[model samples]
Target: MSVKEQVCSLSIGIVLFPNVTQLDFTGTYEVFARLPNAQLYLLAQTLEPIRSDGGLTFLPDTTFTQAPALDVLFVPGGPGINGKMEDEKFLEFLKIQGKQARYVTAVCTGSLLLAAAGLLQGYRATTHWLSLDLLEMLGVETVAERVVIDRNRITGSGVTAGIDFGLALAAELFGDAIAQAIQLGIEYNPQPPFNSGSPQTAPAPVLARVTAASQNVQEIRRQIVQRVVTQLQTTNKLNHIYFA
Candidate 1:
């Protein structure tokens, strides 16, 4: 059956953190928002406005505590993920809701948050090409594809790939026709100014510069991962105690 025919009410919760890449969220939003009977909520720690990595600002609809039950949960990625990885409250909230959400989705480095929440351990997933190896370090089997779907989790690569992730998810939830309609509505056309989306395609100098630019971000992410690992260990210890 088609999604429109089967779904009575579908609510999507999109987690927003400071410095989130706008395209990561908006690309998916454009597709899911167009679903016939879908509701979208911008979820954050506060209902106030948050700024994007590119200077855009968005106001969240609800705080984590106030968010309604969601059929799907989306986490978008950006530089801000470095800080969020170490956030106890944010990680705890994800651990709780992500376990119960019907579909958990992430774009770009957002999959890092899922790993931090202990949801992606031993799961197959994908993320921004630059961060793909990082997922493996967190116990996720990394895929190089633009989108990866493993059971209830859907993960996308890079910022713009969110659109593909959304369309794929649309196909999963509704039907192929619905995804095609949305794709047509959006006039999804790709005409990059340069053929340098990947290091293999880019010039050596360009690739070197890109790698240099990310060094600091990578260092910060390393610290965040360490903190998350520590938190997970603690959680595991507590679980053992409770069970014992």
Candidate 2:
């Protein structure tokens, strides 16, 4: 039997944190929630309502400790991911879940969190363009694509890329027909009014404006990523020594 034939039930857990980009989570949610025999859980450290970077609030239905072993472990990224890179407990949670999940996935800068947790070391992944270098510094082979699937590790680019990521993953999991039906159900058509979605497509002046505005945050993210990378390297070295 094929893999899809064997999958009778699916459970997906999406990790939540303060200041996450709500679109990063919700875009995929709209796609995955349509799967047959699937249960979706919004997971967080606690059940408290969390706010997004854009000031939108979301309520998590399950806590990390209480979450079931997931079929798909999803992580979304935003301004809040910088803090998560330094959060040991949160990284540990990802480490555990990522190990057992059938597919380890992320959208936007969520790939950074996966990389920070050591879950993406051998995977070719993608993240928001602004953080692609930071992800590479985390020892992940980075891809500059809308959706990158290397083995069971799937990653998407910036915010709006989540929809494309979702459809791609849906096809992988349930086959193209179901994914297409869902696309029709959701009317997943894209005709952006402006050609400013990516750095490559945006006008030079617009790109410069965005780059200038995010320079400070980028610097801070680089500093934190370096610290996290240092710790990861140290831990790897110790493990290598201990095992050797």
For residue 80, model 2's alpha carbon misses the true position, in angstroms, by 0.5
- For every candidate structure, what is the RMSD over all alpha carbons to the true structure, in angstroms? 1.7, 0.7
- TM value for model 1: 0.94
Clashes of each: 1, 0
User: Per-residue error at 19 for model 1, in Å?
Assistant: 1.2
Give the alpha carbon lDDT tens digit for every residue of 1-244 in model 2: 7657777999999999999999998999999999888999999999999999999899999999999999999999999998999998999999999999999999999999999999999889999999999999999999999999998999999998888888888888889999999999999888889988899999999999999999999999999999998999999999999999
- What C-alpha lDDT do the candidate models reach, one value each? 0.89, 0.94
Q: Could you tell me which 10 consecutive residues in candidate 1 have the lowest summed lDDT? A: 1-10
Could you tell me the TM-score of candidate 2?
A: 0.98
lDDT of 1 by residue, 49-147 (tens): 899999999999899999887889899999999888878799888888888888888999999999988888878999998888777777789999989
Taking all chains together, each candidate's TM-score versus the true structure is 0.94, 0.98
lDDT score for residue 183 of model 2: 95
